[model samples]
Target: MSRERVSFTELTDVSQKYWPEASVGVSLIAPAIYRLHEYLNRLARELFKQYNLQSAEFETLCALRNSPEPYRITPTELYRKLLVSSGGMTKILLRLEDKELIERPANLADARSRLVALTPKGKSLIEKVTAQLIEQEAELVARIDQPGQLEQHLLRWLAQIESHQDDKGPHL
Candidate 1:
């Protein structure tokens, strides 16, 4: 069976009919955000493909790229930040290392662990990809003509969610 794309208005209407007491906030915003997330994920997959990169590899590069200058972090930190298992991080690091996109150097502070550093080539690649990705993402908000306002709203909502999550204790 094919799933037809339903308009937001129709969805809300049908949802209300099914559950008269359904909260509009959940019915509307959750679905809207979910649909947008699906679209963005597809867009990101296509963009990552053009760079011949897997999602985890690209994300690992990003985590390194966004870190303090010299762009290095311990593998443990990388796995924690990415929420992947140690074994998973090892595989990702190995693949990235083969591409010369990252280098693992012995951590002077810790003999037991090595630091993951972004290579100059990796920096260049990530920067190029980020620029293109931002350009493409901008199109999604172009019609809104109030990207800043939208971002502020999202930030507030995110902070609230994060705060609630924090109350539950450490994520991993």
Candidate 2:
């Protein structure tokens, strides 16, 4: 008995409609990764807009909620965690502070340093949004049948890849 060979068409039928003429080598892996990343990021942006927050602001709020002790993190810590430059982090902090969602405190340990923390209202907002975000994420990730396994696999794949880089260099 002989088995038939499967063509690329069979593996990537749906993708061809939009990315027709894509090279076999590039199309197979790169497009899928790009599309999935794009879609998820778009969805996150939409969700953040619903809360009158941008993606960066939402992330900072959530990060504060997850922090140790006083639920505050220094500007340096936040910039490091968010993988943004000091100026970029400053902009985000100013925007969130304008919304009264966070507080800036003079760090006792270092007078020149400032720490950012979520306000009570910020905590409340995150608690509410987190539940909603989790539900949305669950629905999105449910598209993957075995999410736990898929998540693990994706994390391992990402870890094996080089660090995310920008035009400047390897992102911190």
Q: Choose the strongest candidate by lDDT.
A: 1
Once fitted onto the true fold, the runs of candidate 2 whose alpha carbons sit more than 4 angstroms away are 1-22, 162-172
Residue 62 of model 1, lDDT score:
94
Root-mean-square deviation of Cα positions for candidate 2 versus the true structure, in angstroms:
8.4
How far does residue 60 in candidate 2 sit from its true spot (Å)?
A: 1.3
- The alpha-carbon lDDT assigned to residue 147 of candidate 1 equals 86
Model 2 pairs whose backbones collide: none
**What's the TM-score of every candidate structure?**
0.85, 0.77
lDDT of 1 by residue, 58-87 (tens): 899999998999999999888999999999
How far out, in Å, is residue 109 in model 2?
A: 0.3
For 8-81, candidate 2 gives per-residue lDDT tens digits of: 45657755666667744563566567667766787778877888998889888988999985789898898898
Clashing pairs in 1: none
User: CA lDDT of 166 in candidate 2?
Assistant: 48
